[model samples]
Target: MKDEIVVITGANSGIGKAAAIKFAAEGYTVIMACRNLELSRETQKEIIAVSNNDQVKLMELDTASFASIRTFCSAFKSQYDKLDILIHNAAYMNHGEKYRLSPDNIELTFATNVFGPYLITTLLLDDLKKSKNPRILHACSNIIKHFFDPKRKIDFDQLQGQKKDSKRHSVYKNYCASKMALLMVTFKMADVYQNDGVKVNALQINGAKMSKATLRKVKPHWRIIARIQNLYFPSPSVMAQHYFDICTSDKFETITGKLIDHKQKMMQQPPSHNPNVITQIKQITGSKVYPAYAANPEIQEKLWELCNSLTNKNMVTPSSEQHA
Candidate 1:
């Protein structure tokens, strides 16, 4: 693992920060892609100071923006010859009254949790492939379970969130939809890149009650149950240990497209593996991704067609960093 090079998104604070610090401590080159430059720099200093690791570096990447990803990837490709690990650790939970759009006019939650990782991963797939043991880990939440009601219909008509009707929906609904989309994509990606030795997986850190500061930021309203859970769950650092295991764990080196539990091998949530659920996810993603890139006839038929038409690029090739 020490021989590997790693990049993490949303490392300015919270879980991302913990992952960066732990990865760096293990001697992996940790690139903290943050939206804020000054904060990222300060974080880099702080991480280095504690870990005493000089291999850690900080790069600015506003995961909410496609342009930022392109620029960051371009510069990263120029500097490093290979990328071993990529953790889609950064995510935005929609808690507001309205749906937010990113610079590219995509829904804020959708753009950050779904498109950001997809665009970056597709763009950098070649670099990830260059590694001897490449792995991509996506940070997802159990909170997504709350949104898994089969009774409700999943919406795929508005892939870009161009419509404003969603403004009426609760922020929690929006957040759940985006996460489910991300997990579905991971299932698709794992199948696509498995043959290439790139193990793509998603995991839940459960609750980090010990992280008083960060926990408050994510869930401000604490009821009795929330408070009780906080007392029993692991701290950010302890939970990060599981994340660290996933990033560099040899146990899952051969396992791809799995929904890991606290960094361990486990079955996915019932809905995650349901054939019907898979069908719905494909419909939502326009079939751009299949269970595997090699298989899933619909993925080749629909998603490929739509993604190229939408992005107006070479669909799934390595993306260059595009900046203003």
Candidate 2:
């Protein structure tokens, strides 16, 4: 484990921080790639104090910004020749908020939750390829079931607010769509790099207690519900153990292109209830729909192309930076 290196996005708090601690305790070199350097430094100290492993370090990275991603990768390449594990754990969900754009002018949620991970992976692919057993883990949500519902279709034209339809601008819905996109990227990359000895997989994350910073951002109306979830759901530490397993456990060493839960069971899709209200609404509205985007090879290919174009369009040349 001492020789292994792992980079976890958003590792300052929540499941990311917990995962960082677990990896540090195991003597792995844990790099906490976080948007907030101040918070991350504090967390770095905490992890070192708790795990007694000074290998835990902090790196600034705002996944929503392409420039930051490029800079982070360049600095990482300068310091480490190889990356053993990469965890796409950072996510942005603005419940009850207006649509926002990222630094690259893409939909903010999709930029951070989808495009950022894809771009970072590409930028660091060579480092991952150098590892004997490189693994990339994507954090996903059950909300993707909305996209999988038979009646709902992922309108390619409407992605990233291209359609500009206010009716389709719901933040929560866009978040779900982004998660679905990420799952598609996971499967596609798994196929693309299977022969290259790089394993790519997604985790179907279950409910976990939200951190105070996250709780503060929750809408007032949803606060009570969020609190209730925190009370009954598993803690971040519990969920982090699952992440650790997928990265280090031999059981997952050979697994790729699959969605696995905390119990280590492979999932085809997130569980959905029998009475699908979303399906009923679409039927009543007579809305034109497409099949599930995750399983559709055509949609997956188009998505891959779209992401490539977006990242390239906003490309920034990476240059080495002195470590802080």
Candidate 3:
């Protein structure tokens, strides 16, 4: 375990920071990939002091930007020969009512929450494969199951939150859509890399207490509600234990392509299992949803193609070949 390497995005604070400390204490070399280098450096110092593990390092990464994702992958590959785990922990939620675009000209929330991880994971496949036990974990939300609209399919055409749809969708709606999309990708990757020994899974840290930094990002009203809710919720450290368990536990060694709840229990498959629903989602957003993607190889290929085209990187072959 002392020689294993782990990379966690958005590790400057919140659960990401907590997870990094947990892994470091266990003797893994933890790399903290974050957008803000200064904050990450401070957090790195804190982790080193607490865990007494100086193997923690920081790397610049902004998941919202395609160029930044590519650049970070290149830098990481150059420095590290093997990656045992990759945690897609960075997420964005806008409090403003208006829609915003990332530097890549995609919806801000979707870019960070979905496409960013999509690109980064695909690009780093080779690095991850070098490890004897490779694992990829996506940080998702339980709200996806609650807020997902069964009636409304993913609008690939309006991924950027067009002005015409502003009346119909709110900021929260966009956030849910992004998370649902990510869940789809999570299932798809789990199947795609199953044979290659890379375990892929998503976990929702439901009802976890938010750090002060995270709370500041919440809307004023939501922050008040969150404060009230935090009284009964577990701390981020407690919630992070679930993450550490899934990554290192022998019980989960064969558990690939499943969404785990906050309690570290496997979530039941979504009610909708229609392949057409997955097809419709892929046709628009370039990804499938839930159980459908878990079984359909054709749909998975289409999603990989779309993601490749969007990022301008053919990191994965269309023929289901795993990169070593």
Candidate 4:
């Protein structure tokens, strides 16, 4: 593990910071990809001091911006040769009802939670492939199952907040939709890269205490309740232990395309698996979000084509073909 490399997004605080510390202590060269340079540097210093691991580093990365993602990826490739683990831990949750847009003009929640991770993973696929056992862990949400309504499906027409009059416009619903979409992609990627030796999985850090910075984003009325609830939650360090186990332990060596709960139990099936629903999601997002067991090759191909066109980056060809 001394030479292993791990990249964690949103590493300035909360779960990402804890995971970085854990990985660094275990002798991995941990890179904290964050949006705030100053905060990330401070956290980097803290991790190095605590773990006594000088290999810990920081890089500026804004998941909400495609340009930033591209820049970060280029810098990473120029500096590093291998990436053993990629943890998609960054997320954004708007407290108000109004919708927000990213620099790329996409809905901010979707841009941060879904599109960013999708693009980053594909962009870094080559580096990940260089590792003997590369793993991609998505920090998904348990709120997806709790909030998902079985009767209602994703409305692709309103995916980009194009229909202002749409009734389902609350921030809570938007967040849930983003998380649901992420889960779908998680399953799809696990299948797509399984043969290539990249393992993909999603997990939720259930019952973990959120950082004060996150709680401050909550509305004042709810913030009090949240603070009280947080008192009973486990520390981020405990949650990091679970993440570290999933990433490195021999117990998960053969596990690939599964949704593991906070307790490390595998969920038999995701919340929703309707082909029509999945297809509609793919059509709108230009990405496939479905379980590996139920994947449609035709749809996946089209989604991939759309992604390459949208990002102006060709990922269909093997990395060796382009880099060799």
Candidate 1 vs 3: which has more lDDT: 3
Candidate 1 per-residue lDDT over residues 1-324, each given as its tens digit: 466899999887877888888988888898888888885788889999988899888888887887787778887887788999999988887354475678887777777887778888887888999999888988877655544344543344555665667546566666776666676677778877777888998885566753454546544554445568877877678767777887677787787877776647554333235557566564333312222221334643354344335444523324434321
Q: After superposition, how far is residue 257 of candidate 1 from its true place, in Å?
A: 0.5
Model 1 residue 155 CA deviation (Å) reads 2.1
Off by over 4 Å in 3: 147-149, 164-169, 270-305, 313-324
TM-score of 4: 0.84
Comparing 1 with 3 on TM-score, the higher-scoring candidate is 3
Q: Top model by TM-score, which number?
A: 2
Q: Residue 320's C-alpha lDDT in candidate 3? A: 21
For residues 1-324, could you state the per-residue lDDT of candidate 4 as single tens digits? 499999999988988999999999999999999999976787899999999999998988999888888778877887889899999999988666576678876777878887888888998999999998899998887666532234544444554558555555777777876776677677779888988899898885565787888898789988888899899988888878878988898888889877787678776543344447765554333221223322335544544444445556523323332223
TM agreement with the true structure for every prediction? 0.81, 0.89, 0.85, 0.84
Tens digit per residue, CA lDDT, model 3, 144-188: 643334464445666544653466656677787677778778888
Deviation of model 1 at 243, angstroms:
1.7
The best-first sequence of candidates by lDDT reads 2, 3, 4, 1
Candidate 2 TM-score, true structure as reference: 0.89
Pairs clashing within candidate 3:
none
Which of the two candidates, 1 or 4, achieves a greater lDDT against the reference? 4
Task: Give lDDT per model, in order.
Answer: 0.71, 0.84, 0.78, 0.77
